[model samples]
Target: MSLTLPASRLRTQVASIIEGTGSSPAEARQVADNLVLANLSGHDSHGIGMVPRYVDAAAEGGLKPNSGVKVVLDTGALLTLDGQRGYGQIVGVQAMELGIARAKAHGSCIMTLGQAHHLGRIGHFAEMATAQGLVSMHFVNVLSRPVVAAWGGGDGRFGTNPCCIGIPLPGAEPFLLDFATSRVAQGKMRVAYNKGEKVAPGHLIDENGAPTDDPGVVVVPQSNGLFGALMTFGEHKGYGMAVACELLGGALTGGGTWHRPADTARTVLNGMLTVLIDPAKLGTQAAFETEARAFVDWLRQSPPGAGFDEVQIAGEPERKARAARERDGIWVDDATWSEIMAAGAKVGVRITSAD
Candidate 1:
């Protein structure tokens, strides 16, 4: 079962709960808005379903409220930032703003961030860059847990490293692409478990290293005290990208790699390496926009393949989802709602639905 709530109501409730956890009103609003926007854009795995974990992390001293970022290195076109245990949504925006500023002045910037709490959605940072009229790409690695397996290996070896790229399209909406290297992100599996649903085949491998569609297999403990592992998307191809993300986002950003000894006592953290570019510096904005529009138009003209309705671009689906969700209230599954309510109660915030 699920309930529908207006985005504004949901945001207010989320913000209240986050604020109850010691975050300032502004920081709470930022975190709430980012999570709600993920749901609006059809990425529910990265949305409000995360509230419970965030709450627990705060209680455990893993996530700090209103923490500020620390600059580690500063060059004209390159920089590094330490999040100092702050909320990722806030720190990520700060780092990206710095990147955007440098890009505006130097025509390009490479920025890396380390020791940040879950950075919500990578696409959000890309969208920030696009909103600034800059092209951006981000590689992210989670440093807390390893839920994914290598191409042919059975045990868990890496996090669901994600990559995102956004290109400003001038007159049109920006072209944004974002995806997890795993066949499915761990959060998606958690969402499935919460909803009492199973995942698609080929998304998970059981403790015995056999393919399974049961989402619980990946999260629930087995008789031997081992959990299942998520598979890499596209076999070796996705595995390769995941490895690179770990190196660039983790090692390069000064956040240790996932290969470090498992320490269940440590808090979850994320590291990201972002590259921002000003197309105007390389070529005239007019020419770039013209060429981009032409290519997209030409590509869409191709006939759709079997079982397809139309040829869609990287950012089209998200735009459509946002429009529809804005019209209809966002949906919250029963289990996720229950968890949210409990999390709210812990923080002395009551979440009521306005349906």
Candidate 2:
């Protein structure tokens, strides 16, 4: 069964559930907000669907509700942080703030953070920087051991590495581009399973190295959470990006490479490179703004294909979805809702649908 609830109600429910896990109100709200935003932005896989796993992790001490980030290294344009086992939303927000501050102080900044919990939806963080009038790029690798296979290989050797790019525009929403290097993110597979649907062909390979569309292939405990390997996007090219993301986000972030055998029960190590260009330094800020507006105008005015109303930019859809959902409410499927309610019940929070 599927359920639809107002975004605010859903957020409250989710926050209540998170707070039940020993997280403070602020941390709980941050996590809830991020997950809701993911769903509103059309990334359903990254949304409230993660609540169940989060509850499990909280029970396992994977998330330290009271933890905070600490600065380890700070240079003019570079910094490294330790999340101290805190929730990723809290640490990620602070890291971006540090990155933005450094970029404004210098010409650019790169941030490497470690020991954070599951970092949901990198685009949300990129949007945070973009909202601050800065350009940001993020690369995340999984050190939790790979469940996805390298292209043409059957064994798991790569994470569903994700990369994101955000470019600030003068008067509009920023241009945001984010995607997983895998043919399909594990989250999507999980969503399909929740809906009792099979995955698309070529998305997973069973233990025997044969392609399978069954979501069971990726379900945990079926093969020690390694039943099948996720296929890479673009065959070899996307596989290469996954490798590059792993190296850059892992080794460079000092998070240890995935190739190493380490216990990855509750920590995420990642890196972000942020560049903030001073329009004033480049040229006339007004001039740059004017030209960008002109270009966008021309682009939108271009002829559209059949059934298309207007040409849109990278972040337009997500921005529109966010606006609409904010006005109305976010939709929560039954399975995810049930899990969240169950988790909330543990903490004296009762969640019910609106009439």
Candidate 3:
């Protein structure tokens, strides 16, 4: 069974739970809004379901409350930031703000951030840049756990590195492209496990390297002491992109790579490399908007194939999902709701009803 709650009410409940963990009301609200927005956008894997883990991390001191970020290096157009193990939603927003400021002044900026908590939805940062009428791209890598397999390999070797790019449209919602390199994110598998559901074929493999749809295979330890692994999205193509993220976001940013030893005392960390550009610097905004509109409109004219609806652009589906979810309310599955309740209980926060 599942419960549906209005987005605003859901955000309030989530914020209350986070605040009980020692986060200020403002910080809690930011994190809650970010997670709920992911749910609204139809990406439940990155939604409020993660609150349990966040609470655990905070209690264990792996994620700090009210933590601050610092600039480790600065060169005007290029910089690196250390998040000091703070909540990714907060640290990420600060990092992007700095990047946007530098880009506004210099026309372009590249920034790398390390030691951040799970950076919720990567597209959110891109959308931030888009709101400022700037173009932005982000590459992210995770450390401490390997949940994805390399191309042609059977075992887990890397995290589900994600890539995102956002392009601002003068009078329209920004065009955002974001996806995990893995066929499915590890969190998606967790969602499946929580729902007591099996995943689709080709999304995962068992400990013995046999293809399996069982989400439990990915979460539970097998007799051989290994867990199932997610596959790369497009064979070599996705594997290549994942590698690039590891190198740029992980190694280059000074965040340890998957191959490095884990820090048992700390929780997982994310490293990100973001590039922001002022489109106006390259050409007139008027010319750019005209050409962009023309191209997108032309592309939309393509006829749909069998078993398909009309053509949809990179960001159209998310926009549609957001609209529908806002009107219908967000759905939380039974298992995830139980987890959230338990997590809230740990911090003396009670959620009596969906309403």
Off by over 4 Å in 3: 260-266, 284-287
Q: Which stretches in model 1 have alpha-carbon errors above 4 Å?
A: 261-266, 284-287
Question: After aligning candidate 3 to the native by TM-score, how far in Å is the CA of 145 from where it should be?
Answer: 1.9
Top candidate, metric lDDT: 1
Candidate 2, 1-355: lDDT as tens digits = 8876777777887888788888888888989999988989878878887776677677777667878889999986888888776777788888888888887777577788776777888898888887877778888886564678888898678678888888778867778988999988788887777678887787888867788888767655455544677888899999999988888777777765677533436334444433444454454667777887889889998999899988998888888888888787776667666776776676677777752
Predicted candidate 3 versus true structure: per-residue lDDT over 1-355, tens digit per residue: 8888899998999999999889999999999999999999999999999898889889988888787779999899998999989999999999999999999989999999999988989999998999999999999998755778888898788888999999997677789999999998787888889888987898898988889999887766778777878899988999999999999888888876888432333366799999999988876778999999888888779899899888777778888999999999998888899989999999999995644
Candidate 1: lDDT over CA atoms? 0.89
lDDT of each: 0.89, 0.77, 0.88
Lowest summed-lDDT stretch of 10 residues in model 1?
Answer: 259-268
Q: Which pairs clash in model 1?
A: none
CA deviation > 4 Å runs, candidate 2: 223-226, 260-279, 282-302, 305-310, 346-350
lDDT score, residue 338, model 2? 73
User: Which candidate number maximizes TM-score?
Assistant: 1
Which model is ahead, 2 or 3, in terms of TM-score? 3
